[model samples]
Target chain A: MADELLEVTDLTMRFGGLRAVDALSFVARRGEITAVIGPNGAGKTTVFNCITGFYRPTGGGVLLTHADGARFALQRLPGHRIARRARVARTFQNIRLFAGMTVLENLLVAQHNTLMAATGFGILAVLGLSRYPVAERQAIERAREWLDAIGLTERADDPAGALPYGAQRRLEIARAMCIDPVLLCLDEPAAGLNPRESDELNRLLLRIRADGCSILLIEHDMGVVMRISDHIIVLDHGRKISDGTPEQVRADPHVIAAYLGEGDEDEVPAEEVVA
Target chain B: MKSALRDAVLSALVALRPVPVAIAVAAVFVGRLLLLAWRGRSRAAARHANRAFAERLTQAGKYVAPLLLIVALAVPLSGDRYYLHLGILVMTYVMLGWGLNIVVGLAGLLDLGYVAFYAVGAYSYAIISTTYGLGFWTCLPIAGILAAIWGIMLGFPVLRLRGDYLAIVTLAFGEIIRIVITNWVSLTNGPNGISGIPRPTLFGLKFTPAGGPGSFSDFFHLPPSPTWRAVYLYYVILVLALLTNWVTLRLRRLPLGRAWEALREDEVACRSLGINVTVTKLTAFAIGALFGGFAGAFFATRQAFVSPESFTFIESAIVLSIVVLGGLGSQLGVALAALVMIGGFEVFRALADYRMLVFGAALVLIMVLRPRGLVAGRTPTVALGRKREISAELVAQGRG
Candidate 1:
């Protein structure tokens, strides 16, 4: 469809004898939260790694369609170019923040490409000529906006590593957002978040979607997936078991079987099927 | 107070011998450690105390900097040629420390072959001036650019390397440059070295007495003395070192500088941020080499000669030690370190035979007392609202 922002077709990733992700195909629509949830080792992150160009998929193509109808084959591009040219920003499962830098500087670093261009690759910035000062102020303004949105404006001067764990998670998302990405991929952002923080994350994701950015989330939290996701894809043994709206995926027998297992279906409570 | 008086008496009794003085210092350091341990202080508490002490030292450094600059500016007034020469040596290393600081401090690239670029600059100046009869001013920028080109050349092959691998390659690169200079007799004159290198002139006015019409002494109507040449060379290096510091400080606030620090903090994070890591790293290498090149040209002109022996691996190690001792990425710390390390050596010249032993002992004592070097606190380049200091604990020791 014209609204389809990302298409992963027949994606296959193998590590020696193990097939981490096997022929997984899915589409993330524009301006929608597409949750990819499965049990541990279901290859959700491997799929993310492939799409973000962290890994070269063994087979098939991951295509991204930009707002103006430009197409990019993500797997062929370098890891950085995927983020630079294709505007795909991702947060790592194990928060890859510039821990040594200040919270505001972390966000500023995210806007590196923009500021670099404005600075004329540092020449004009050093010379104090051109539109660099204006660009730098605007960059700081954008960083300030995100810091306010994430409620980290007060601690903006502190080193990112010194922030509380939950604050760090929020800052990572804010940093990713500063890239002005069209597609934001988050890997287990709610992993260590408290219940209250998880709710805040859900609101943040919804706000991002409301702002017309697409989100591809790999989350194990059923509450976050079901409540915030517009579409859901279920993976089992690196294969797609179910794909549809939240209600449809929740109702699928295969997804229930994948979560609860075949013979132990009665052993677990029905309410705890996906949890 | 009794024990302190006793320790002072013992140190004073052995003041005539350098070895005993070093022993006294070591003994004092150990006694303090024992006292701290006896008080039942935890390692964390000890670390905290050390950091507080370092913070005070940095504050003192703030007040001392201008005073030191005044002392440096007024050195030639004493007309003591030995002190003037010593000042030149210390400032050369200071410039070199600042240059290597760009690669090792800010970028967190441990360059063990930094002296290679220094060698390139020195040789470039020596050859250009002596062979082509080019003036020192003409050769200075050319030498800097040539060294920067060599830096880029070295940077290309090692873009994928980091940590120990990067160190090893750079170490080998330093050796390679020295060995090439040792064997390349046709171009570099080999171990015989290049001699009679022309000294720098003040806009075509020579520093020599023999330049009857166009000499500094003749034009200014002053008595001709060799000390004038030494004084002029001192100012040349002083200006060059200050320029290096200025450029570095300005770059720290710019985008490229931020990118370098970010690259140091987390290379993978930098890549995901859409930063071209290759360009970021290469610029650091090139710029760092550029300063080293400037210092090298200055070294060549001041000595009026160039030799392969001057650019040995130990020179690289000494420069690297100055950077580490000063505290990585701290410019003031680097200058202080170079002063202490180079100037300290000169101060202890009376202890001839035992110099290395005392130097090594002092280094160990400093490392034990201030593990993070002299200045460990980092002030952010950009601040919103009031700026706060970031502790060394929060900063990443960029392995690359």
Candidate 2:
């Protein structure tokens, strides 16, 4: 309980007659990579949406505990405040970079609150009276560091939309990291990456985890989910079917059935079916 | 290609029966030749051409600003009252275009009711100065603040809307303000209009012919002339317009301006990055109205009258067109657009009955040729290394 970074209890989201996520409960420990994977419509994204404050769950609580033991009920906060106050950052299933803005600007926008405060909400900066120049230089320096980390340093001035698909995916993660989030929620980060790019992503994500930030990932790529995730939560029909370490969840009968369909599970191993 | 050219020429001929036929034919032929040249190029070659054009535009822009400033400063020396009046009008529209650019261009909020604020500013100056006997200098800031409050009032209800829906609400707001000024008899005089507004003075020195203790002629010991008043008013509006432009340019480099462009690019992304969308939108609206109010105050003092007829839906449409035709967020483009639109309107006065038709045709032609307006490229606010001008193709035209 002391190591728990996020605690989602009885999370329920209903759209009229359909239950997108029903009474799903899970806990992501501090500084660990927790993967949430399921079949096409197993409500994996719904769980993420609820945690990120994109969709207010019909009934439930999302409690995030900061390192200093500060508690924030994510659902009660507004969308932007979830990122600002709760330090929860997320990337969309479909990439949503400020495609028109330059790579550096995209990262700078992530640190908007910090610079805004330093600039006295624009008054001081306009009047050339604040500590904004120093703050801006530091912000740009941090952006350059991330750009280097993602191998996008040369293209820092180019529009984010102009980057290759794999690079864009990496940049999205880098943008998310720029916020210095306590928790990073990625929705299907490895969706369309090639094998080589996927491998690179594994290293980048590992680097992020090693930096002491907790990760909550929704990935369909079994290779990525199984390889990097220290803990895994499997969902079926908006309910948690399996929750354990990678091997334990991989060997569960319910997770296999959810992926491969019911009653033919004995013929093929879960690895081939899920992967 | 030949058939398409023929069709274009045929349409132009049909549309311009009142004008000279040779001019229309020449225009079509030149357009066709350019299109053919463009189509014959390879993809790489086309991209090269685009880059070269953008570079040349930038090169020219560096010199154009100073040149234009010199020309503007010399207009008062010409001693032509008509040209001075025209300069004042163009500068007013330029200020309006820049103000609206913050909303519809940068923040991407379509505001069709901008003139409502303009009307509020004019009325504030008119009623306050007339009733309270305050000078223009004293009433100017009050007018701006009052308009900003009205801006905030309008911003609240329309915060949830976007695109066409937002445009409709703002359009209705413009009409509502006009209707209010029309019917509010006790306050606005109910369409009878307000007149005899005071002219601006030089530090309390009235521009009067009779030499006295508080007259401009007496203070300077110069012969009094009516042209001096026109020249002074021209310089006043010039300073105000420049201030608007300078402040806008400075804001673009700050966090607030970047947030506006980011909001335009994608509102959902702005929220995900911890940007307060409500405050950003309201600030853009309020700031834009503040400038509009300043221009309105100037207009009241210049004309010495305030009327509901002057602040109509057409005025809003014209200002919005100037922003669009000026290529949205580009400050230089907006100023150029105001010059062309306002100045060209006067230039076509000889045609009398056909002036509107010619103006409409010219607008259509410009839209067809340059879909992104005159200056389509964007300069990035901040850069990690050498700053690059974003190509027009890469810039996102906000939902407006």
Candidate 3:
């Protein structure tokens, strides 16, 4: 509990009569890669939405314990306040990079709340009287660092949509990083990537973890999940089937049964469970 | 041998024709290039070249402001009173377009009743100047403040609505303002309207022909003509329009401005970025209305009259078209569109009956030819080292 960065206590999200996430509880440890893997309708993403404040949970609470010892009940905050106040940032499954903005601007926009506050919400900035120039220079510096980290400095000026699929995936992660979040939530970061790109994503996640950031990842790629995740949580039918180290979760019979349910093939192949 | 050579040349000419084949071939080539540009280049070299071209355009954009100002200043020296008046009118629309740009273009709010703020400004100035005996300068800021208040009022209801619903409510708001002014006889003089609104004086100096003390003619010791007032009014509006441009340009680079555009691109994304969406929308409305109010006051003084008829839904449509036809986020595009829309139409005034028909056709043609508006590229507010212009077509509307 001392190392727990995020605690989800009996989180439940119900849509009318349907319970998308029912009585889900888990802890994401500080400075480690914790992943949630489940079948398509198993409500893994529903947990992300609730924790990120995108969907107000029908019941239960999400507590985020910052590295500095401050705690925030993320469930009480709005979507924006979750990011601004709780210092938790998330990327979408569908790659929500600002398509019109340049790769560099996409990163700069992530730091918008801070920059706006630095310039006194823009009045002094307009009058040429604010400390905005210094703040802006620092923002650009941070954006450049991310651009370099993602190997996207060459395409920094290009429109984000102009990047190839693999690069866009990395750019989304880089953009979320620009928020300087204590906890980063990435939803299926390697969903469509080839093996090489998937390897690159694993390295990037490892590097981010090395920088003292806790990551809560939701992914389906078994190779990625087994390669990088320190801890794994598996869900089936809106309930947590198993939670443990990757090896433990990989060997669990319940997790295998959840993936290979009723003799119907799901996205996760049964044979890959061994590897 | 001579005949054979001549026959070959003749055959080539016949294949080419005078215009049709040549034009068709040229069109095909250009169409192919545009398709490639729209789809973007697969090769890194082509993208590099495109970036270079866009960067050059951004460099050229730096000089466009000063050049425009110089051209605007030299206009009055031509000594055509009619053109000066026309220039003033064009600048008025330029101000209105820039104001509405903040709302519709930057913030992505489809405000159909922007002219209501303009009306509030004009009426505020008229009532203050005529009844309270205030000067033009004195009433200017008051007019802007009043319109901005109305803008905030409009902002509250439409905060939850977006796109077409927001447009519908704003359109209704415009009609309501006009109707209220028309019915409020004691305050607004009803359909008769308010007239003899005093002209703005140059400090204490009047543009009177009697050549008395404190009159422009006596103070400057120049021959008085009716054109003097028109010329002075031209400069006043020019200054105001330039101020609008200056403030808008500066704001576009600021954090708030960037936030507005970010919200426009994706509201959900903006909220996730920790931006207060309500404050962002309200500021866009208030700032846009502030300029609308300023232009409205200028209109009242310029015409020496005030009436509900001037602030019709058509005025809103005209301002909206100016922003759309110009290209949404391009400041230079808005100004150019105002000229083409307002000033260009003046040239066709002799054909009065067919004037509107031509204007309508022209608008449709422009929209068809350039769906992203005339100036489609947006210069990004933040860049690494060198900025590049982003094609508007590449930008997804992002509601999905």
Candidate 1 lDDT by residue in tens digits, A36-55: 99989999999999998889
Candidate 1 local lDDT, B1-400, one digit each (tens): 1122223223323543557567757776886678678656577787678878877887787787788789889999999999899999999999999999999899988888999999999999999999889998899999999999999999999989988778878888999999999999999999999999998999888999453678999999888888889999999999999889988988888788888999889898888878889989999999999999999999999988889999877788788878887888888889888999899988888988577556666765676677667887677878788767788888877878
Task: Report the C-alpha lDDT of model 3 over A1-275, residue by residue, as the tens digit.
Answer: 33999999999999999999999999999988999999999999999999999999999999999878899999899888888888888988987777888898888888988888888757788889989999999998999988889999988999987899999999989888888888999999998999999999999999999998899999999999999999999999899999999999989978987877645446656665554
Here, model 2's chain A TM-score works out at 0.95
Model 2, position B148: C-alpha lDDT score: 90
Give the 10-residue window scoring lowest on summed lDDT in candidate 2 chain B. Answer: B1-10
Candidate 2 docking class: medium
Could you say which candidate leads in lDDT? 1
Clashes of 2: 0
Instruction: Indicate the TM-score of model 2.
Output: 0.92
Better of 1 and 3 by lDDT: 1
Model 3: residues with Cα > 4 Å off, grouped in runs: A263-275, B1-66, B209-211, B397-400
Give the per-residue lDDT digits (tens) of candidate 3, residues B1-400: 1122223222333342444434444555676577668756566776567656555655676787678778899999999998999999999999999999889888888887888999999999999999999999999999999999999999998898966677778989999999999999999999899999989899978876556778887788898777888899999998988898888889888878887878877787777677788898999999999999999999999999999999987788788888877888789889888999999889999976556555555665565456566676788887776787787766643221
For every candidate structure, what is the RMSD over all alpha carbons to the true structure, in angstroms? 5.8, 4.9, 9.6
Best of the two (2, 3) by lDDT: 2
Interface RMSD of each: 1.0, 1.0, 1.3
